[model samples]
Target: MRHTDVVIIGGGPAGLAAAVKLWEQGIRDILILEREHHLGGILRQCIHDGFGLTRFGETLSGPEYAQRFIDQVEKYKIPYITDVTVIGLDKEKKVTAAHKEGILEIQAKAVVLAMGCRERTRGAISIPGERPAGVYTAGVAQAYMNLQNIMVGKEVIILGSGDIGMIMARRMTLEGAHVKGVFEVQPYASGLPRNVEQCLNDYGIPLKLSHTVTDIKGRDRLESVVISQVDEKMQPVPGTEKEYPCDTLILSVGLIPENELSLMAGVKLDERTKGPEVNEKHETTVPGIFAAGNVLQVHDLVDFVSMEAEELADSVAEYIKKDEKAEAEHTQGEEAEEYMADVVTDGNVSHTVPQKISGKKDIRLCMRVRRPMKNCAIQLIQGGKVIQEKKMKKAIPAEMIQIPVKAGILKEKENLEVKVIW
Candidate 1:
């Protein structure tokens, strides 16, 4: 059986960044597994610029942003295997993967999961629709248009206001396709406001909020769709049915973190994020195993994903070294689980990362609001006392909110609660 110090289970931005960080930290025995023929993950298909602004202080296309790290991985000669799909994982840190040649197994001292997330499809939302050729998820349509030379349709109507859906509205328009409009079920847009402005507004596309696609009409290919305004409960309201003729229906409803492998490894999942329940170090319930990027929670920006993965890699290096030292001495380390405390939410706050924390070091609490709010104040409460707070002019579900807290303030706190007050 093959062995390595660490095994990163994806070659996307997250996995690449983690591998580079681990190498920099002097942990050279690492392996990256990529399911695609090439690396760079989804960024290869994201041709539009506006990425890397946070990381590089300059605008770059998705592929360009990813290539920067891919170059580093190559420069350092970080080991990687392409066209490999990891099939199994366990608490023992044993990884089983399938490849063109045959099944492969590896035993690693530590594991990092960076498989990212998947788009919510038509079946996920159970959209009442016929099996038609013109219907495609926003990501699939993006791959078809950007990677493949095929254009999805000439007349398009997007069913969700997600970032990808909005971007595709512009993409299809630039490709000479007529985008009728974009309909969303929620009262507010699900995508970032900047995307809604640059992609939809700038392209002269209409975004109808509180609306949804009710039924799809077609035989072999898509012909038209039935749309209706949704009530407060998100149920389709009667007497608001409208029909629009379009050849394509694109969905960008939402994203789900890919965690099937994490589950197989006995990692506890957060019901809210549908990802692994991780501590401040990005360590899952199973020691020696960690998770980052979209596999931990869907991120709004790729730059943030890389940054989070780097942080996780730092923690993994520390874990590996600590374990080696313990092995050399034949002594078990001290248990610090008692210092861990749950990070809960109150008021309009939705969910948070580091679902729990040890308060032993400074940490960033990434979270989102349940709805839009103006003139809001985010407060971190510990043991009935306010420890840290940040005032924001506005908070929206589309944009994630991150607040930094110091360990000095959180030390000895039994629990922490985040509240967004408007």
Candidate 2:
């Protein structure tokens, strides 16, 4: 068995950032295990130039952004195990992993989970079709086209208007494919506003909202798709059915956090985010086991992922230097609280992160709305008293909204409420 002060699973941006931060904090005994042969994770396949505007203050391709972090890891001489997959974790933060070399075990004082997320496939959506050859997830299609220089098809109809789907629509168009349109089940687009404008609108690509691809028809290759509009109940309207003939179909329904190791380690998960339940510090229910990046919540940008990783690394350093007994006592005290705030969704609200709060510290509430509204007001109320309010000229579901609460606000409140009023 090997021992280390810190063990980070997955060597993507999150893991690399955590390692760098830990190194700055004077923690040297760290190990990063990556399943792939190299680092960067999904960013390696993305060759577009829109990344790193907020983080680096410059437009960079995905690989370029990853290269910046890779340089840090190399400069610090961080030890890493590539092509090693973590299979499980125990209560004591023991990590079990396997690679070509065979099974390896590591007893780590603290573990950071940055395994990232996976794309939703056709099976998850259950689109009716002949298990055809032309269907691909947006990410897979991106890898095939951008990295492998393989053309997926000449005609495409993308299902879902998420960022990946929107981006791929433009990519296919640039590659000389005829993009029929993009269909979204939700009433509003799930992608960022700039993506929708630059990727879809600028190219005259159609976006069908409140509509879904009800059926896919093909024999060997994708031939066509039948789309229909849906009502508030999400049931298809019988008369609104329309068919579009296309050679390929791309689905970007959603992303699910890779949490098998988290489950094995007995970490509590949030039902809404479909990720691990984490506090402000990004620590899970199991002490010394932390999670960040897309594993905690699906961030819209890589900049937010880096920010989360930096904060998580600080927490790990504190855990390593502090007394174990005192840490356990503090954790137990926080868990002993009975009353907690449930941030619910109303008419226009979509979902809120950090689903449960203990009212013990200052917190930032991040959320998205269900639709676009003009001249809207966001109100934070507790026990019929307004604690915070903000006005916006326009608010859309595509962008995430963040509101920070001071510790003083929680001192007098038993219940916290968030609402959108237009």
Candidate 3:
């Protein structure tokens, strides 16, 4: 079959960034396979301005932000095939894909998993309701409105105050639709503070926390929804149902990392993040197979996704530079276990990226807290001693917390622990 030094799946932001970085490192034999007909991934549908602030120090729309990378790929003449959906991946780095022509196979020296993520739907959360036509995920609604020039509904009820949901609430309002309200099951808003303020407060859209839609009304099309307050356990409170009439119900519950191909390649998954477990180098348990972007962990920002992909690209370059036989032998049996350190977290931590570290160099640990807390400190512990600690004014589940640790303190440590205390 065809052979390449690197084969990246999904020509999204992550794959684009990784491919560019690999090319910059003098890796010429590279190919990118994208399932969609075009590049840019989710950013193509996201038309709002406010992206690229951290990455480019400027406010840009989603398409504009993605275009910068797309331009770079063109300048470098990086090869990418669109409308090609990868159907299978093996441990030996062979990729099977299907396109308009027929089945395609590639023998890759290294594979980067950049498949990104998918929006959680009504059925995923098990929202009790009759199947209605007006219900849509926030992303789907965005694509319909921005790409297809179709309005989802006149009156909208958004469930889950996710960043996308909040943004859609503002979009619907601007489009002359009356947004009933945004209901969240969590005690606190799931979206960023800026989103809640700019999207909801500025538009006068009420965000009802500790509340959820218990029942959905209407038969063929959405007519109304029953909202109810939730207790500490997030269970719906009795006799607290409030009916709000609306033509559409938009769900922004959550995002799940796309990993069906990764699983086929036998990558170990982290239950906490619902993504593949990776080391500091972003390499999965299956050697030469690496994952980045949302496929590794759900990132709060697209900038971070690109940054992580670049870092993983560096590791992939190093892998290609080494002897394949020696690298494989070194990562087997007891040597592999000794080469990596296990990372453990306290109950306060929701999850972490790079579940293991080499302890050979400094690393930036990324994680999120379980809930919001004021006056908290995140401690990096080794052998029951706090090696490093960072105090924060506040910690929230909506934001990711990154801490940089020194290698000197972690060198001899077999296990490292992370604790969030308030």
State which candidate has the highest lDDT.
Answer: 1
lDDT (Cα, 0-100) at 183 in candidate 3: 93
Model 3 misplaced regions, further than 4 Å: 324-338
Q: Write the per-residue lDDT of candidate 3 for residues 1-422, one digit (tens) a residue.
A: 89998999988889999999999988888999998889999999999998888889999998998899999999999999999989999999999999899999999989999999999999898989778789999999999999999999999999999999999999999999999899999999999999999999999999999999989989889889999999999999999999999999999999999989989999999999989999888999999899999988988789889888999999999888664545677853223453788899999999888899878877889999999999999999888899999999999999989888888888565788999889
The residue-level lDDT of candidate 1 at 406 comes to: 85
lDDT score of residue 131 within candidate 2: 75
| Candidate 1 runs further than 4 Å off | 333-338
Error of 3 at 332 (Å): 13
What is candidate 3's CA lDDT for residue 93? Answer: 96
Q: Candidate 1, residues 173-247: lDDT per residue as tens digits?
A: 999999999999999999999999999999899999999999999999999999999999999999999999989
Every candidate's lDDT: 0.93, 0.86, 0.91
Q: Flag clash pairs in model 3.
A: none
lDDT of 3 at 251: 96
Instruction: Give the C-alpha miss distance for residue 95 in model 2, angstroms.
Output: 0.9
Error of 3 at 274 (Å): 0.3
Query: Model 3 lDDT vs. the true structure?
Result: 0.91
- Native RMSD of candidate 2 (Å): 3.0
Of the pair 1 and 2, which is ahead by lDDT?
1
